[model samples]
Target: MVSVHRAGALLNEASCFLCRRRTHHHLRFPTPGFALPREASPSRRSSLAAPFGRICTRAQAMGTESYTFGPYKIHPGEVFYSTDLSYAMVNLRPLLPGHVLVCPKREVKRFVDLTVDETSDLWVTARNVGAQLERYHRASSLTFAIQDGPQAGQTVPHVHIHILPRKPGDFEKNDKIYDAIDEKEQELKETLDLDKDRKDRSSEEMACEADEYRVLFS
Candidate 1:
């Protein structure tokens, strides 16, 4: 048998749990066959919806619902692939035809700043993005590089792995790609500054690019 008590009130002739005194306003026990209507309580509906809400929130955090990188809150159309730990997107500037970047969800400056799991996921994601880029660009090779810090030529403060698909004669010299990195980054900055009309890719363009890459990754 269960007993419940309210302030100065006894239930079912039971003593008040707090005051230890029998009082009026006793509650009668329900008969065995009696039950509340299924739809009568809002709490039941809320309980049922809670898991679905949690699932949506989890999906949003994991990049299924949203994609964000550095200061940019990326549109869904810009994200080609994503995992719980990291996501891959098309590069704003391309050293090669199919260059892309893979980065952890949290912003960090250097490789050493990443946790063990993030470090592992970063490389794994980079590798996967490399393979996909290769197939998408029909390239025989790929260049994977990380500008670890400012001294190493990292333009963005956030840690990112650049995956550049390469083909023969793509660069006059193999080491020229390194020089191209600084040149391309500078050019992008200049374009953004000098060209007021220049803007990010439209939703339709990003969606199309994402779809093309998604097929390659698939």
Candidate 2:
């Protein structure tokens, strides 16, 4: 079994099954003097039209602001959209090309743990995010899943809704995505441990993707 220990405010260590050793994973931290990519100019935001324009307008009317997800803050330029109760973010390990997570601002562990307001906001946010992702990825279908608890395959303790954009024939079997989700973290860990070239996506890369999505939803 793999065990994880929170090492500090900005890092965590997880035991590896292969080497029986611990590997430290750096939490996403703001880099000093880090600037947005040159290509991430404000004009980019105007190019990709948001499919769910009314959703964005509604969120703005609610005076919704960004919040923190784990250690990372959900900034306006880094998220597709957000409401007062929940926000959607780019996934670190995307199950598909356009997979993202919709999470409540409150750090709840299960779906049932959400407050009535949060529950409503979560699905509404998911729907908007899903629509945007489908348009962005030109997906034929979408998968909105919630792994309610650990027994139900919730890897991270936080309550997050998975919005996966799917294409026809993306997999030989339709249910393969679930198996892929179950094994993705472990597979990435093993690859990272043994193959030095196979590193996790850099913070810059993630921010870049987020920027693109921000543009798409703008």
Candidate 3:
């Protein structure tokens, strides 16, 4: 997010800005099985107590295993929601409350690079995730945005849709809060300066929030 001074410019100059990144996570339904990386939380570790075979899962395995945005590796334990084609995860530095990202599993850099199925699935997943977040965050509205390419301010070379839960009067100017893309990915400074001031949330903090969000999907 941002301040009122830059809000107006953001609409025109930014054009489109979504979240920063996406990866793997727990696929709540079909398996209820997600393998935490070797150094995962105790609770997430318990999820893999069953067997190594069950834990041999991927995001597409109806369970969150591990995946990547482009070259950046994401911790599997922190992703809370995903489908066969897409995933929704907590932002390391969210623009607003209940802000999250939904991305296709396949890391296609450009929006046009996605096939019809990936495009359809990405939007549908964003819609479903947004609806749940709206209810959970008890917000009045939501903003769904995507930065299609470098010119559009895409940073990670991956396609991601930002889902920001909005509330009245939350911002001096509502758009101010949505200043940049996902703050998390900006740490790597893949492309733009949308997020240059903030520090990142610790892995533990991310995993903790992700654990809480998983209930919304389950």
Candidate 4:
């Protein structure tokens, strides 16, 4: 049932539920199964449509990926860096080539939740990949960054650091494209979960690791 009162309450805040900021918006809920005591006026319908359109537009901008990071069973491909205990990949973003994401197989939501060894491996993997980027991709520098939550602009809750290879002229050095895309990359990470597990680690070690074990099995 569509309650006018409830709708009014939601509108009173005038904030987007997804982004959570005060903004004038409206959405037309399909009314087939909903009870409506009063018909929506033309102005009301128009107002709702605009915001709904914006929401859909923003959603369509973020494309979904087929797979997640960590140990997973798939066709064997190029292995970037591995410790027999962890692994990483060159992120698809490729700001200057050799961009990689270091993540655990376990589905840990926050950096603080990672077990000690997993935490160590995360940074170590990133560091190793960063060096390889310098040696192989000839990048002048590498940047490591993590977004822990939505407020921090972390779209995906999964903890991962972006290793971007920087070059002298990659950007005008005045543009903030990297930062903007980095935020989107985090969202992309949140949408996928790694499917494989690291077997070399003993059950005891795996237990202590914060990698996503259940998602791999399920």
Q: Pick the candidate with the highest lDDT.
A: 3
- How much is the lDDT of residue 26 in candidate 3? 30
Model 1 quality (TM-score): 0.64
Across 74-140, the per-residue lDDT of candidate 1 in tens digits comes to: 6665677887889887655454445677889888877898999999998999898898777655678
Model 4: which ten-residue window has the lowest total lDDT?
208-217
| Residue 105, candidate 3: alpha-carbon lDDT | 88
Q: What TM-score would every model get versus the actual structure? A: 0.64, 0.61, 0.64, 0.49
Give the residue spans of candidate 1 off by over 4 A: 1-64, 187-203
Q: Write the per-residue lDDT of candidate 4 for residues 1-218, one digit (tens) a residue.
A: 86998876565334223322111211234231111113333443322221211221111111232234433321112233445445564333233334456777576778889999999888887776677655544556777878776677766656778776665544444246446555546534442343233221222211111111111211
lDDT of 3 by residue, 54-77 (tens): 111122222546777765666675
Q: What is the Å distance of residue 10 in model 3 from its true position?
A: 47
Model 2, position 67, has a per-residue lDDT of 62
> In candidate 4, which residue ranges exceed 4 Å CA deviation?
1-79, 174-178, 186-218
* Candidate 4 overall lDDT versus native: 0.44
lDDT of 4 at 209: 15
Those runs of model 3 whose alpha carbons end farther than 4 Å from true positions after fitting are: 1-64, 182-199
